[model samples]
Target chain A: MDSIIFLRPTRGLAALNLRDLWVYRELVYFLMWRDLKVRYKQTLLGASWAILQPVVQMVIFTLLFGGVANLSSEGVPYPVFNFTALLPWGLFSKALSDAGRALVNNRNMITKVYFPRLVIPVSSVLAGLVDFAIAFGVLVLIIIYYHFAPGANFDFHFTPALLTLPLFLILALVSALGFSLWLSAMNVIYRDVGHVLPFLTQIWFFITPIVYSSSEISSKWQWLYALNPMTGVIEGFRWAILGTQSTPALLLIISTLVAVVVLISGLFYFRRMERSFADEI
Target chain B: MDDIAIRVENISKSYRIGTAPERYRTLRDSITNAGRHILAARHLAARLSAGRSDLARSPDPSSHSTIWALKDVSFDVRRGQVLGIVGRNGAGKSTLLKILSRVTEPSTGQAEIHGRVGSLLEVGTGFHPELTGRENIYLNGAILGMKRVEIERKFDEIVEFSEVGQFIDTPVKRYSSGMYLRLAFAVAAHLEPEILVVDEVLAVGDAEFQRKCLGKMSDVAQAGRTVLFVSHNMSAILRLTEETLVLEKGRLAYRAATPEAVDYYMAAGFSDAGERLWQASEVPADAAPFQPLALRVRDPKGRVVDTARSTEPLSIEVEYRLDQPITGLRVGIYLLTMRGEYVFTSFDTDDPGKFEQHSTRPAGHYVSRCTLPANWLNEGRYVLAVNASAFHVKRYFWDDHALAFNVDATGAPGKHWPEPRLGPVRPALDWMIETL
Candidate 1:
C-alpha cells in the first residue's frame, strides 16, 4: 500500500521549513534586489517615488485633518504627524498589494524553475521597502525643520525606544508577508482573489490608523485593536520617534505575539498550497 | 553507478481532472464534501459508545481521489550522456522533467540529481515580457539559480549566440516571436549548468536557428555535461542523443540506443506499408474543401502501384470525391521536403491539352494524374496532395492528401541515390549555361 501525504489546512504548519529558505539566501537577495531595480528602472524620478508617496500623503492629510478637521497632532506639526503614520502604512499597503499577487506575476518562473516558493512574496515585500527607504529620508528633513532641536516641549524627544523601530518594522513586515503569502498562493488557483486585493487593502488601511492616531480609540477597545498587529507597530513607531507616552506596553506585547503567529501560520498555508500552483497556474 | 548523474526512484504524481464547462459543478461538490466531512466527524463521535483516544489521534489518507499522471517511474542517466525522451503527446514526458527539475514534488518517490540544472521547459518561461531583453537575461539567470557573477561572466556570450545585439535593450514584448525564442534559448543554453533539460521549445524557430541550437546542444553535451532532451523530431533526436527512452501513456515502453528507440517509437505509432498515417484528421491536408479518397501511384492498367523503379515511367494518381462541379478547376500537386519546405509544385494543366472541363460529377471517380518523365524525381519519400481551385486559382476550396509514396532507385543495380536525396522529396532539374 502506498502511503498518502495529506497536505491541506491541518498539515500546512509542518509543510514549510525555514531551513530550506536559509539555504537559498543568495537567491532571495538577488530576487529582492532585482525587484527593487525593476520598480525604478526607466523612471525619471527613480528612488524619489518612495519619499514622494508619503510626502504627498502628508500634504493631503495636513490640509484635510489639520486644516479642516482640526485633528490634534499631540502639539506637533500635522504634516510630520501624518507623515509619521503614513511611513509604516505606506510600506505595509504597497508590500501587501505586491506580495498578494507575486506568485501569479512569476507564474512562468514557478512552473519552469525550482526554488523556495516563499522567496517570491518575501522579495516583493523587501522591494517595497526600497520605496520606504527613499520616503524615510524626506521625513527626517521635515522632522529637523519642525523641531529645530530634540526636546520635551517640541514633542520630539529622541529616546532609547528608537532601538525598537527595527522590531516594529519587522512586525509590519511579518503581517504583510503572512497575509500576502496566503493571498498570492490562493490567487494562483482562484483568480478572483486578485480582483478583491485592492478592496481588501482599502479596508485594511482604514483599520490600521494610518490617517489617524490609535490613541483616540476607546480604551476598552484598544486591546482588540492591538490584535491587528499593525496597531501596535504604528503606535510603537510614534512612541519611538515622538517620545510620546510609550505605546501601551501591553498592546505592543500582544500585537508582537499576533504578528509572529500570523507569520508562521501564513507560511505554513502558503507552502501547502504551493505544490499545486504550477499545474493550476 | 558512480558516474550516474540522475537517479529516479519510484516517482509518482497525480492530478484531479476537471472540465472547464463543469468547473462550477466540481467546485460546488468540493464545498459540499468539506461540509459533509465536518458533519460526519461529529456524527461518528456521537455514535461511539466509548471514547477511543487512539482513533481520534489519526486521520485516513486514502479518502481523497485523483488521477495519477505518473506512476512508479524510475530511470538513471550517466554524466555526459545525452538522453532523448520521445513519446506521444500527454505521455508524461513533461511531468517527468518537471519532477527532475524539482518544479513540482513527486508524490511517492524522489529524483536525486548530482549537479545544478538549467531547464527550458517552454519558450518565454522565466521571462517577463515587460522587462528588456537585457533585464530578462539577468532575471532568468537568477531564477535558474545561477550566481550573479556567473551570469555576468557569460552574459556577452549569450547575447552573441542569440544574434540579438541590437534589440538587447528593448523589452521582449516587442520582439518578434522568432526573436523571443532565440533570445530566450540563448540565455538558457549559455547558463552552463552541470545538467541541461530542454523540452519541445525548439520546434518554433526557423530551420537555421534550430540547426544552430542543435549544434549548441551537441557541443554542450560533448563538454562532459548531462543533457535530457525531449522532442518529437526523430531525426534531430537521433542526431543529438546517444541514448533514448520511449514513454507511452506514462510508462516506459523502450530504452536503448537512439536508433533502436526511434525504431520502436516509429513502429509503435506506424504501420508496415510505409504508411505512417495514424489520425488523418490531425494531419492537415494540402486541400481543404475536398474529402480525400486515396493518393497512390499506378501503372498503365490502373492497378495501384506501391513501389516505383527509378528509371520506369510512373503515374502519380490523386483521387478525391467532390459533392458538386467546380468550374475552371485546376488540380495542383505540391512536393514538400522533409523539413516542411515546398520543393516544387506541378499542376495537371502544366500541359495545355491536360486541362479538362467538368460540367458534372465524373460519375464514378475523379482522379488527377501527373506523369513523371523517366528518372526525373530522385529516390525518396514524396507527399502527393491534390488541390481544387478555379483556373486562375483566386480562391482555393479543397485539397486532399490522397497519396504519399517512396521512390527507390534500387532498380538500377549498379547505382546508389545521392545522400542529399534522403529528404522527403527529391526533384531532378535542368542546369544550362549559355556562353556569350
Candidate 2:
C-alpha cells in the first residue's frame, strides 16, 4: 500500500539497498536480542563466561610475561596492561568467529524470507559488544584494585586521555564489522573457511601486540606493522585507558584507512554474494 | 495497472550445481575445480583456433552447468482476488513463489508488486528453539515485517489462536510438534500485508487447526486483499480461490476458473506405461511356473488409455500364461489410489461359486479382468497391484504397482459443495429434500 517493489535479475555491481536495511532495522534489533538471550541460556554460570575467559587468559599472560620473561609494562602493572589490550581484543576476536558462522548458522531465516541479508552478520558482530561490556567491568575493577591496593607500585590518575576511549572503541567496532563481513559471506560458498578461522584469529592475536608492548618491535618495521588495523585500535585503546605513550598519528591514520577500506569493500563483496545466498544456503 | 497487485513477466531461475553438490563446498574442491576450468578453457581456445566445427557449435558451457528450475513463467493477480497455484512435485510451484517473494533473484525477467507482499513459504521461519513461545511471537512477527507495536496489539489474539496460552512463557523447544506448528501458523496468519503469498503451509497442522487457518485466510481474502495460494489440496483450492494456474514442469500448462484448472491439472499427470508388459527378468524365479504376460487399462469405449474421465467406467484386463497345471489359482487385481491407499481388491473368483465352478485351473493362456463402475473414483492417479494366489493354498506370484492410471472427476456429485470428500471413492448416492 505504501510503495511499489520491483524485483529483477541482477547482472553486476548491485547497489547495497541501504533503504531496505533502514526499513528492516527492527528485525536486526530482534536478532541481536535473540543472540544475546540465547548465548547465556542453560549455562550454569551465565554471563560470567565473558568475564572468566579474559580474566583467566590475563592471569596466564601476566605470570608468563611479567614474571618469567621480564617484559616491561611501561609504568602500568602487567595485569592492567595485558587486561586493557584483552578487552578490545576480545571484542574483535569474538566478532570474527561469531560472524564467520553467523550466515551458515542463521541460514533458516535467510532462505525463508526476504530481508537485507547483511542484518545477520551485522547483528552478530554487534552482539559481541554485550560480552565485551561485561568483560570491561572487570577491567575497571582491576584498575581500581591497582589504584587503592596497599603497597601498590603502580600510579593511577584520571587523565584527559580517558575521553578518547569511546573513539578507539568505535574504531575497534568498525574493524570487527569490516572483517566479519568478509568471513561470513565467504563462509557461505567455501565452508572450509570456517575451519581456517581459528588459526586465522590465533595468528591475528599474536601480531596485534596484546601481550607485548609495541615498543619492543624494531622502529624500521613500524610502517609494515601498522598495516594491521587492530594494531591501531589495540594500541590506541591502551593509550587512552592506561595513559601509555601515544601512538604516532601516522600509524593511527593508516589503521583507520585500512579499517574503512575493509569495511567498504566488505560491504561490496557481501552485496555481491547476497543474491545467491538463498540458493546456496 | 492501478488495480493490479502483482505482475510477473517472463521470470525464470536456474541453479548452478558446481562440480557435484555437498552440504557445503570445500576450498580444496573449489580451488582444484578452478584450476581445471582454466585448463579446459585453454583447450577450448586451441580447438576453436583450429576451427573444430563441433567445438564451435557447442552450446555455452554456463547453460550446461545450470538447470532451469523455472522457465518463462508469467502471471498477474488483480487486487482482492484469491488465485491458487496447482502443480505436481518438481513442477516449480515453490520455485515461482520463492522468486516472487524475493527469496532468490530470478535468472531472467522480473516481477513487480504494487503493494506490500507478505509470503509464508514456511511457517515459524525465524523461531529459535531456545526462545520462549512469547518471545518467539515477537521475533517471528518482526521477521515477517510487522512492527513491534503491531505485534503488541495482536499479541493476545495470536496466543489465543495458537491455544498455547497456558505454555506461552515456556521455551518452544519444549513444546510438542503440534503445538509448535499451531504457534507458527498463528503468527504467520496475522501478517496483514496487502498481498499474501502462501505455499502449502496448511498441509501440516491438525484438521481443527487447518480449519482455523482456512477461516482466517478467508477473512484475509474477503478484506479486499490480493492472495496467491499454492497447494496440492484441490478442495481447499476450490473452496478459497476464484481462479487458478496450473504449472507442469516449470511451464504454465493452464489457467482458468478454479474447478476447470483443478480438473486439467489432475488429468494431465497420466502415469505412463499404463499397459505394462511383464518381461522375463521382472518376474521372480520362484514364480517361474506362472508367467504374467500383460496388463492394460481400457476406457468405457473399449479403447486403451492411461487416463479416463471420472464419470466413465474403466476396465483393467491382465493376460498371463500358466506353464503347468495349477489348482485353485485365483488371479486378482488390487486397485489403489496414488498414495497406496486401497480402493478395493477384486479377484476373478470373488463371486461365490468360484467363477462358475472353475476352481481347478489347467495350464494355458488365461485372461482376468475387472470393471470399475462409472462415477466411482475421485479425480487422482491410482496404481494397480496384481496378485495370483489361492486361500489356504500356495502363493503363486505377486507384483506391486503392476500398472498405473489417472481419472478426472470434474463433474463428480456434490461439486457445488465447498467441503472436501474424505476418501478415494466418490459414490453418487441418491439424495432428495423432503417437505416436513
Candidate 3:
C-alpha cells in the first residue's frame, strides 16, 4: 500500500524529489521519444537534417579558417580537426536550446498535470542525443574518407583514449542540461530567456574552441577557458577521436568540477522556481 | 481516522492582485523594485534613528496588494466517498484542486492524502499532435501519474472505450475533434488510482460522452476509491456524489448530502439572504452613477425568499441609485439554468412603452421588478444575472450568474409522476383522451 503523503508549502531550499523522479522515469523516456518523433515528423529532410547541420558547419569553418585564412590545424587535416570539435559543439548548442525552451513549450502539461517537473528539461536534453548520434556517424565517415583518400597524408591513430569518448559526451550532456535547467526555469518567469537563447548559443559557440584549435590560446588563459566546461569536452573529443593533441588533464579536471557545480546549483534553482511555474506560466 | 482518505486543514491560497495576470516580474523589474525597496528602507531607518515615531508605525506594504483565493478552507473525505465541489467562477475551486494535485503549492496549511492521487485537471493535457493515438494514450497516462505497466495493462480497454481502434496508429492530429476528446477521456477514465481529482473537463465532450464519464465516475466511486469532482453541471453532481461542498467567496459555506447542499448553494446567491447587496467596497470605482443597491427574489406576498414554489408567481427586483441622469440606460435580468443554459433575458425597458417613458430619467433612486407567471419554470435551480447597459453604446455593470434561486414543484402539474421532467419550463398542456 502507498504510504500517506503530506503536502505543504516547501520552505528554505527546495530538495530534489529523487524518489518521485524514479517512479516517473517512464514519463521521461516517453517524453524523450515524443520529442525525437515530433522533430522529424512532416519534415521533407527528416533525420537527414541532423547530419546536415554539423557537416555544413564543418565545411564552412574549414573554408573560412583553414583554406581562406591559412590557420594551422596542428598537423592534422583542418576538416578532420574542426569536424571533431563540431560534433560535441553541435550537441551542446542543440541540447541547450531545446532543453531551455522545454518548460515554456509544455506549459499546458505543467499546469494541468502532476509529475516530476525535471522530466521536461531532462528529456529535452536526452532527445538531442539521438541527433548527436546521427551527426557522429557522419563524422566517422569523414574520418575514414580522410584516412584512405589518395595522398591524404593524414596520420590517424586509434588509441585506448577512444574508450573515454563516452565520458566526455556525458560531460557535454551534463553541462548542457545544467545550463538548460536554469534557462528553462527562468524562461517560465521572465520569457526573455527564450528571446536571448539563440544569441547565447551563438556567443557560446565561438568561445568553445570549435572553429579554431585551443592551442592558439596562451597556456595561461587555458585554465580560464576550461571554466567554460565545453572547452574540456571539445578538446577531449579531439584527443579521443583524432589523437591530435595530448589530453589536457588539468583542463579536463577543472571543467568537470565546473560542470558539477553548474549542475548542482541549477538543480536547486529549478526546484526552487518550480512551485510557482503553474501559477506564473 | 483510518477511514478518512483525504484531509485538508486550513488550506489557503493568496494571489497578488492589480498585477499582470500569470506574469512574473522580469529580472529588470525585480532589480529596480529591490533597489527602490532598499532605498526606502534606508530612508525609514534614518527617520527612526532621528527619533521620529511616525516612521515606524506604517504597515507592511505587501499585504494591500494580495487577495486570498481560498481562506481557511478545511474538509475531509472518507474512503469510497465521491465529493462534489460547487462554486462560482473564481471561488478558488480550481486553486484548491491545483494545490491538492501538487501542480501548485498552497500559501498556508497542508493536505494529507492516504493513497495515490491521479488528477485529470484537463483532458489531452500532454497529447502531442504529431504522436499517434496509441503513443498519446501512454504519454497521457504517464502524465496523469499512472505507471507504465498500468497503462500497458489498460491499453486495450482504453482503445475500446475510446472507440478509436481503427485510428490507434494514426496521429491524433488527423483524428476529428470528437475522436480526440474520446481518446483523451478514455485514458483518464481508465486510470485506477486510489484517489481521483477531476475538474470541469467533462463539458468538453458531447452529451453521450458526458453520460459515459458520469457512469465511469460512479463506477470508480463504487469500487471504493475516493473522488473529488468539481463541475458546474448539478445533475452530474446529483447523480455521482453522495456529499457535496459549496464554496462562497473562497470560504466553505455549506457541506451536506448532495441534495441539501445543492439546494443551499442554489438559494445562497451572493449572500445568505438570497439577495446581493452591493457594499461600497465591493463596487468598482468606475461604476459611478450606476451603483446597484440590492437585488432579490421575492415571493408573491413580496417577501424575500430563496426558494419559490413553481405554482405561484415570483418577482425579481433590482434597486439602483443613479447619482446622475443617464439616457438609454436599460437594466435587465438574465435567467439561466444551473448548468448555464440560458432561459431568457428581460430588460426593465424591454416593452417599448416603458422604454419611451424611462428614456432619460433624472437622477433618482429606482427599482425595476419583473414577474414570472406561475407554471413557467421547471423544478430545478436557476441563476439570475443583472446587467445595466445602453443600446449599442456601452455596458455599465454586468454580472453573469450573479444570483441563484431554486424553483420547487410542490403543487405544479404532473407532480404525481414521481420522475423529474427535463428542460427549463414545465407548463401544463391540457390533453383530452377519449376511449377511441
Candidate 4:
C-alpha cells in the first residue's frame, strides 16, 4: 500500500512534529549558515564587530558603574568580573532579538514556500552562537591579561565548576528561544511586537545581573530575582568562570524550571499560530 | 498500491473581506466589536444563539464583508495525471493552490496526498541578492523542499541550464534581472518531486526562456508525474494538461477536457455570444454614479458576434448609466492583445466637435460606440477594457480587461502570406511597387 499524508487544520494545542523537524535538519543548518554569512557581509569590521560589541560595553560599564558607582564585584576586578557575565548576557540578548525577528525577516520564504516554521527562529538563535564564541575569545584574553597584570589582585583558577559552563549556556539558549518563539509568532500577526521589542529587551537587561553581582540584591529579594530566567544564567556563568560564589542550587533549579516551562509553552503557542503565518504575513 | 495521487474532499476557505489590512485584530478592536454586537442584539440574544450554526454558514445579511474564497471544492487526481486550473482574478485559484501546498489551512474538509509535494508558487522565491549564484541555487532548492544531496546531485545540470557558469561565483546582486530569474527557474525546474504544483511563475523571463520553460513542463508532464498547473496563458494550459477545472466566484463552474473548459471559462458571465450584462450586485458600491450596464461587440451589420471577420468593420458598444450630471466625463475603450499589449485607447471625446457637443452629460442611460475599419486588426483574441473618467479630476470607474472576443483573418489581406503575423493590429495600406 502507498504511504498517505493527510493535512487538516490544527485545532486546539497541537504537538510539535519532531520527526518532520528531524527530516529537515539539513535545512535548519543551511538557514543558520545563511544568517551567519549574511550578518557579516559587506561590513568592513566583519566578525570583529561581534567581539568588539561586548568589549566596548564592558569598558563603558567599568567606567560608569564599576568606578563611578563603586559597585562590588565580589572582590574580583570589575572588568574581568563584568566580562564573564556579559558573555552570557550578550548571547541571550542577541539570540532573543534575532530569533524574534527571524520570521518577519524571512517573509518571502514564509509566504512563498513551506518548511517546518520552527526552523526559522531556531536557526536565528543558533546563528548567534558564532558571535558568542568570538566574544568569548575576547573574554579569555582579558582574563589572562588581568592574571599577570602588575599590582592586580586577581587570581586565575580553573575549577571543575567550569564543566557546568555548557549547562548555563544551554539554559540561556532555551530562555532566548522561548521568548523568541512567542515574539516571532506574535510579530507576524501584530507588528506592535516589533516596535516594542527593543524597549522590552532594554528593560530586561537592567533586571538581570551583568555589571553587578546578584549578591548586591537583598537576601529577601533573591527569590524574586531568580524569577527572571537570565539571573541564574548570568550568575551561573560568573560562578563557573570566576569561581566566586558557591553553587546557587536553588536559583539554578528555579530558573531551570521556569526556562523549561517557557520553552514548552512557547513551542505550543508557535505551533498553534503556524497555520496562519502564510496568510497573515 | 493506491492509484490516486491527490484527493481533495469538500475543502472550503473563507476570509473576512473589506476589513482593515491589519490582519491581527487588536484587543481593543475585538472588544469594541463584541460589545457593539452584544448591545445591539441584547433583545435577540437567545434567538441569535439558537441560529448560530446557520449564521456561521452565511455571514450576517446586513454585513456583506465575508467572502468564501473556495467553497466545497473537491477533486481527485490519479497518478501521473496533469490537471490545470483556470480562473479570473480573485476566482479562488491562488487560494486553492495555497491550501494544497499547505501554506494555509482550509476552514473545512481536508486533502490527502500519496506522495511528496513540491511547489514553485513564485519564481526566485527566497533568493537573497547578496548571495552568490551558487549559494542562491542551494538556498532556493532547499526552499522548494529539495534535500542537500539532491541539490548537490543536480547542481551541475542547473548551472548548465541557466548558462550562468561564468558568474556562478559572483553575487546575484551584480547579475542582471534576466540572469537572476534564469538561475532561479533552473533550480526550481530541477526539483524532481513526485507531485509538482506551479503557479504563473513562468510569466517572467524572455520569450525564449518562456518557451524553454514550457518545453520543460511538457517533459515533466509526459514523465508520468502528477502536476497541477495554474496559468493565465491558455495556450500553455492547453498544451500541458489534458483535464482542466474552471472556478467562478469561489465555486467549481466546470470540469472537462482542456479546450472545452477554456471555452466555458472564456464565455463566463456573457448572456449572448459577444455581450455581457452586469448585474447590480456584480458592480462595486464605489462605482455608483457611473454604473456599467452592458458591453457588446458587433459586426458591420449590427449583429452581436463572438468572432469577427477581419475583412469587415467591427464595432464595440459600452452602455452605462449616469445617476447625475457629470462634467468632462469621457467613456473610452482600451484595445489590447490577449497577451496584454495595448494596441490603442480611443475615447468618445477624442474629436474636438464631439468633446464640445457633450462636455457635460446629463443623467441618463447612454451607449458609446467605436468602430474599427476593415482589415485593421490581426487575427487573434483581443480584450476590451472600459474606462469612464474626467481627464485629471478622478476616475469614476474602470474595469481592465472586462471583455474578450476573437478576430478571424479568414478574408483579411494577409491571406496570401500563409504565415502568422506578429503584433496586435494588421492594417492594410496602399502599396505601389516600382519596376526598380
lDDT per prediction?
0.74, 0.86, 0.87, 0.86
For candidate 4, the docking band is medium
| Regions of model 2 farther than 4 Å from truth | B32-63, B271-436
In model 4, the runs with Cα more than 4 Å from the true position are: B22-24, B30-64, B273-310, B315-371, B376-401, B405-436
> TM-scores of the first chain across all predictions?
0.90, 0.97, 0.98, 0.98
Count clashes in each candidate, considering only residues at least 3 apart in sequence or on different chains.
Answer: 8, 0, 0, 0
Clashing pairs in 1: A51-A135, B287-B398, B287-B399, B288-B399, B289-B398, B294-B402, B295-B402, B295-B403
iRMSD, per candidate, in listed order: 7.0, 1.1, 1.1, 1.6
Candidates ranked, most accurate by lDDT first? 3, 2, 4, 1
Model 3 agreement with the true structure over B153-255: per-residue lDDT tens digits: 9999999999999999999999999999999999999988899999987878888988888888888989999999998777788888889999988899899
Q: State the lDDT of candidate 1 residue by residue for A56-126, as single tens digits.
A: 77898888888998887776677877787788888888877888878888877888888889888988888
Candidate RMSDs in Å, in order, are 7.9, 9.2, 6.2, 5.9
Give candidate 1 misplaced runs (Cα > 4 Å). Answer: A1-15, A40-48, A148-155, B21-30, B36-68, B129-133, B165-180, B271-436
The full ranking of all candidates by DockQ, starting with the best, is 3, 2, 4, 1
**TM-score against truth, every candidate:** 0.77, 0.80, 0.84, 0.85
lDDT (tens digit, per residue) of candidate 4 on B109-194? 88998887878788788888889999999888887888899999999999998989999999999999889989999999999778
lDDT of 3 at A185: 92
Instruction: Return the candidate ranking by TM-score, descending.
Output: 4, 3, 2, 1
List candidate 3 stretches off by more than 4 Å. Answer: B22-24, B36-61, B270-375, B378-382, B385-400, B404-428, B433-436
Give the DockQ of candidate 1: 0.25
